[model samples]
Target: MDQGIVKLLPAVRGIAREAGEVILRYYTDTVTAHVKADGSPVTAADNAAEAVILPALHHLTPDIPVISEEQHAAGKSPPGDHGTYWLVDPLDGTKGFIEHTGEFTVNIGLIKDGVPVLGVMYLPVDGDTYAAAGPGTAVYGARARHDVPISCRVVPADGLVVLSSRRHGDRERLDKFLEGKLVKEHRHSSSALKFCLIARGEVDIYPRFGPTCEWDTAAGHAILLAAGGSIETPDGQSLAYGKPRYLNGEFIAYGRK
Candidate 1:
């Protein structure tokens, strides 16, 4: 199964990039956002990207069930076997995308037994991609170059480099969480880019206090895991997937853990 997953990674990356391309077709300063029942924003870019990804993913692996954001939001999720499935967020950071922040991404992750075994995250604006298939298979790429191996770096003696949500986060809670830690630098990013930054050794930790769905983190979690990092609950358990309604609680992502 690992071999099969490895073989399918390139195809998954291709699908993510293609979805990103579709998303870019809807990118503009005046992009409109519609409010979902849950009060979160959605856009045509999100739907268009999902439209590209779902069919491509189905064609690539017919047996694997897909749980995509838009599809699920529309009450059209598939029943999975619980052992293997696809989790996709066609457009993460929709607010940023609508506001011209250019921080959104196309995320695809393969989960097996509640763990993400494969992930592909593509930034449509820059054509940057981060991918992984199990451990020791993490890589980063862009239009100029592809598949450059990446890994997490040990925290420097000075302090930890941290990433926080740009659009939203529990600032008071995050401050409390970092009270005793030595933070050398603190930065803000939208969506799963924080995970990619840690995977590429640009950052050290991401302490998220607010709620997020499974699709929001799965792909980034897989890439982080493949890069020798870890994401754990507040009490220090490994973060598992396939939760009811795909909701996630607080978790901290770390590099070189």
Candidate 2:
């Protein structure tokens, strides 16, 4: 691991935890939810969490620009070619959060050269924090004070399992994809947790055929890759970060070495 990234881990973890707390406060309250111009949902918790996380990240590395979901929805873009930047989804799985499912997450990722170099996904309800830098990844359940190494399971074909999205699901395509394959079917999960499930070796694949932004998947992708897994477009190209529009194409996250 790069020494600089190692140095950055503490601050990243702190910001993620703080942001998670901010989201949780609203999670337990009666909050208002609205749709953005793009027709995606947003809530007060999302803004509150971003307010806490963005500034903390800037303070940690003043030179690096940040691109956050709330900021982008407000038409704010990262100002310069930083070579390295922070990608944030302060509150992911807002629909689930609004429904009081406690499955939302605060995602923070460091991207360099169009790829995530470090990432953190924090679940406030459970106090589980998943982090990765380079090729090292771990899951820390904050309340439990336990750290578990995270890695994808290399299951044989017979044991293959796929995790899909519950909210933004595509049933027809998914059924077609799995028609001939011998695998177990599981219900979809929300947010980056789906990717984390694959990273932790609980699922073999996650194929998302619906729309998603860069911030939505970058952190999870980084952690998954660090955990000896890979995510790619359906065409088999590795998903790249820092695209011109910040929108991601449909992709498949695979649990494999």
Which candidate should be chosen as best, given TM-score against the real structure?
Answer: 1
| RMSD (Å) of each candidate, 1 decimal | 1.2, 1.5
Q: How far in Å is the alpha carbon of 157 misplaced in model 2?
A: 5.2
- Candidate 2 per-residue lDDT, tens place, 1-257, comes to 77798679878988999988878877665768898888878998899999999889888999889999999888897765656888999999998898888889999988898888888999999888888888865454566687778888887666578898878888899888877777765767888898889888889998899989989988888899899888899888999887776899989999883
lDDT of 1 by residue, 17-47 (tens): 8888888888865888899999999999999
Q: Where does candidate 1 have its weakest 10-residue lDDT segment?
A: 77-86
lDDT of each: 0.92, 0.85
TM-score of 1: 0.97
Error of 1 at 93 (Å): 0.9
